[model samples]
Target: MKPNEKQVNIELTCTEIGGLWGIFIQESMNIRFLTYFMHHLQDEEIKPLTKVALEISEGRLDKIKQIFIKENFPVPRGFAEDDVNLSAPPLFHDIFSLSYIYMMNRLAMINFSYTASNNVRLDVLDFFTECIHTSTEMFGKVVKMMLSKGIYDRPPKMEYPKEIEFVQKGSFLTGIVGKKRPLNAIELSEIFFNIERNYFSVLVMLGFAQVIKDKKLKNHVIRGKTLSEQQIKFFNNLMMEEDLLGTVPVGMEVTDSTSSPFSDKLIFSMINVLNSVDISLISHAMSVSMRTDLTAQYSKIIAEVMLYSKDTFDIVVEKKWLEQPPLVTNRKKLLNSD
Candidate 1:
């Protein structure tokens, strides 16, 4: 970084790796659930797909560990064998499992793109590049399987415009009062996709509420269900105002079984995954909305969720379930003591 300093054979420092939080948290989760799926899954069609993702997650985690070691950074104590109980009954239906993979990997692909783009270190770049490729392959497989099963929820259909047209008036941005313009195709796409995203959270929290045994976490998960319900309602009302169908959650797909299939730590960590992504999704919606009112709505929701996410993080901390990300040394403390 200085004129007199000469550096060679560069290795990645923690700061140089972009999106490590996402990679660490997400792959840790994948390790838990992917292992669970491999244990309880009976579907011949989806088993291989699950295994492929598991291998990638395990391999990536190992590489991340080695990098952290070489840098003398504390390797995060991510979820492990203790986080899940494979012998427990299958908590989710096989179909839901497949859909989860599809949706999660889709999210991963989005994250991997940003991670790769922002990273300067060559190995970090290469790792996320491969992440994108692996996620794409898994997403394609699950989507094909879901489509063949005839359960893939397609977005609302609209007739093509007779001709290309430009925005004719400033009213397009107004939604606070008076008749608002019909949701444009881009607006429609984002809203629908957002609802679908919340739909996953709603059902997952529901399932978590049922199976989680710890009293505090049970209450927390139940409240999370309430939060997700409110979010889904917000998105659904927008869709319904235009006569578009709202997303049907996989809540009913969860069986009425009251067994703990995963540890409280894993359940809490999964909620962390949901919390992190919800913030990002809201930010993206805010960026893409043309209507002032829609942006305001997303902002309000983001504020509420930010507080909720802090509470969620507090729970993880209280239980010491959180793993610290790599940080710089406290040299001043050492110098003061000496």
Candidate 2:
């Protein structure tokens, strides 16, 4: 090899850049919430858990910053200390904080796994692989904490079938007609988790609605709460049809504090993220659901959530709170510019 040879490092692809940027923004927002929660946390049992979560988010942000710096890319201005008021009174209980950590870690695991699968760049792949591992570890810790505190909501258990069974009739696929069949294990599992997810959203929206100052934004959040309730009711009734009940996780409670702990922009961004994730979750649920009723109901829920998410996007744009993600070069526009 020639001593004068220089190594040509490959540049980041659009997907890799976008993934890191999105994760940076998300981690920044999460850091703010965790900081505030840490300030008000009273449960000694989960204090270390919350601290670990904060450390993980902060570490992720640092890694992203390093990557952007090395690549000579402009660092995104995500949420900051200014976006959260650490001195504000607690708007939710400690149990709710634990639940939030558990759910957020669950989401991080799902998203990071997908990002890892799509990116072939060595650095980006390694980063997401670490993210997946850390998120899974955090999720397990939160689950254990919830269980120890007697708040973990277990999914409904089915009785063991003594004999193997097969679908003998076409009624298994029919849900809207007379005398529909019972909910199968997979169908029941999907409905069960969706109910749990919406219930958490309902709690968060209720708290946000209470503290949001703008009448319009408050109303929008209230509408989100109502939508979550409606979705929960539908899932519950669907379960009742099979003579089974969906377990609603308890111990999450919002305080009476009307003061906002987060900036309006942060609040709306959080809502936007949650609603967008729900749309994806419900769509996936629809694909797995075999019963016509379940699929049809999931479709309707997706449509409603999509509309709600659109409003959130508009609000973020109108308020100039939306962060522009990385995009492909606009060759035509660049050529047209003076």
Candidate 3:
């Protein structure tokens, strides 16, 4: 293919990727609300925990929305009027909801890892990696809680560790000095920035979902609360590691009041911006392999969030609050002509 043709293909791929990412964001929002709505029946003891998880999911959702806007990409209508049941019976009990949260976090870790590794954009990779760390920590905490309640799942142990012996003819440098190095501050900062952006978005989504009347949706929001708090800490730590002040753009306010604080157009626009940011973060994380653990965690978080966001889209569609964007056909062909 010609250089121009190749460029068009690349652009098309990126656009598709961005759209796919948007789907994830929308689904995440849905999951957040579902968890929150389910937690309303719990006593005071479990209420706080549910609240924390809800916050985290909402915050991440907001970040994804901002990313799409920043990239000038169209954010898809994630949910439709047919997706939610405002009058349905409760879908999950309190303990079941908590277990679901734990499962979602674990899944998030896996997804973050995949994105961090595959994304070519350095900034995007970094962001996902940081998310991975945050999600992992959250998972750990949830697991602890499950253990305390004797509700945590336990798999059978393996027989033994797999081991291999290396040849002994290596030089001193080969044995110790030639190992892979740590990521530089610049690289770390890029990843950190990505994490900060994602966390901000998640918090925003959680705050917005708090007002949904459905018990399942409300429970999801509650679960996201703690995840958001943990993400903030992760971003702060990343900033400190890079010797820089931790700062991330807060997209928009999410409130529980019956009055809408912002127009539906504005909300979807912000979601687009957040999606762009997430892509950037994933790119950065991929540039440096030293942060593998972080990358893995973020991937998982993104995947789980995507599931929940889809649910939220359904809710928005049902309420007729979603704003439609101008549809664009295959623009790649036009790019090739020029």
Candidate 4:
């Protein structure tokens, strides 16, 4: 290894730029989420987790913003002062807040893992690596805190197997006919995880629906809630048909107050961000699902969700609320310049 053979630090690749744009927006929104949680969190054990979350998001934002500037890219107009009203009363219970952070941190860790793997630039790689570490710590603390508080709903338990065996049955690939094979761990985990998100999604959309004043926005929220309910039914019934404990929604445990604690923009942005993740999650579930019926179900739902998410973007754009991310100049337009 010669001194001159050292790897050169290159400019940010398109993947890095695009991926960072996505992560930066998500991090910014999380900052807003943490701020609200910090203001409303009552439990001493829970407040520390919010603080950890806040610190992680704030620090990561600084690094991401610096990279955007370094590469002459436009930093996204993510969540801002207008997004949250800290003076408002607590909209949800402390337990719900803790659970929210727990779920969000789990998602963030997965996000950073993917971003880190795809990154080529040293600084970008370094930034997302740090994010993965911080998110790991944050979720770890959140899980411990939730368990100690007796709010952690552990994933469904399964029987322990004594030995490993190779599959010889052709029934493994078929679910359209008699005697469908039981769900493997991969299929069950994905289905269960999706059910969990749908449960929380219903809670959030229901809250937003009750509080938001704009009729159009209110209608949109209502639709999202309905979609969540349908999806939950679809997934939960799959398990119920198998004679298993169906997915239980975490008791829509929100306050009765109709006053919104967040701006419409914030609500819409959050829904958009999470709905995007649902598409990816559903795709993953589809890939792992060997059963014909389950795979088709995933595909059908993905199309529905993808359409809904597109509508969300359309609304954001119509209201001029969509933030422009970094992009190369329009070369064709440039060629036409006088």
By TM-score, the best candidate is 2
Cα misplacement distance, residue 188 of candidate 3 (Å): 36
TM-score of 3: 0.43
**lDDT of candidate 3 vs native?**
0.52
Error of 3 at 199 (Å): 30
- lDDT per residue, candidate 2, 1-338, as tens digits? 36554332678888888899999999999999999999999888878899999999999999999989989999999998899887788899989888889889988998998888888777778889999999999999999988998888888889988999887888778988867777778888888888888888998998899899899999999999999999999988877767776566575589999998999999999998899889988998899888898888999999999999999899899999999997788999999999
Model 3 stretches with alpha carbons more than 4 Å out: 1-23, 26-39, 80-87, 158-338
Candidate 3 lDDT, 248-303, residue by residue in tens: 43333333344323234334433443444454455556455344445565666556
For each candidate, what is the lDDT? Answer: 0.81, 0.88, 0.52, 0.83
Task: Estimate, for each residue in 168-282, the C-alpha lDDT of model 4 and write its tens digit.
Answer: 9888889888688888888989888888888888888877887899999899888888888898998889988877778675455678768888988889988897788889989
Model 2: per-residue Cα lDDT at residue 281 = 87
Residue pairs in clash, model 1: none
TM per prediction? 0.91, 0.95, 0.43, 0.93
Count of clashes in candidate 3:
124
Candidate ranking (lDDT, best to worst): 2, 4, 1, 3
Off by over 4 Å in 4: 1-9
Candidate 1: regions farther than 4 A off = 1-8, 18-22, 70-73, 331-338
* Candidate 2 runs further than 4 Å off: 1-8
Candidate 1 worst ten-residue window by lDDT: 4-13
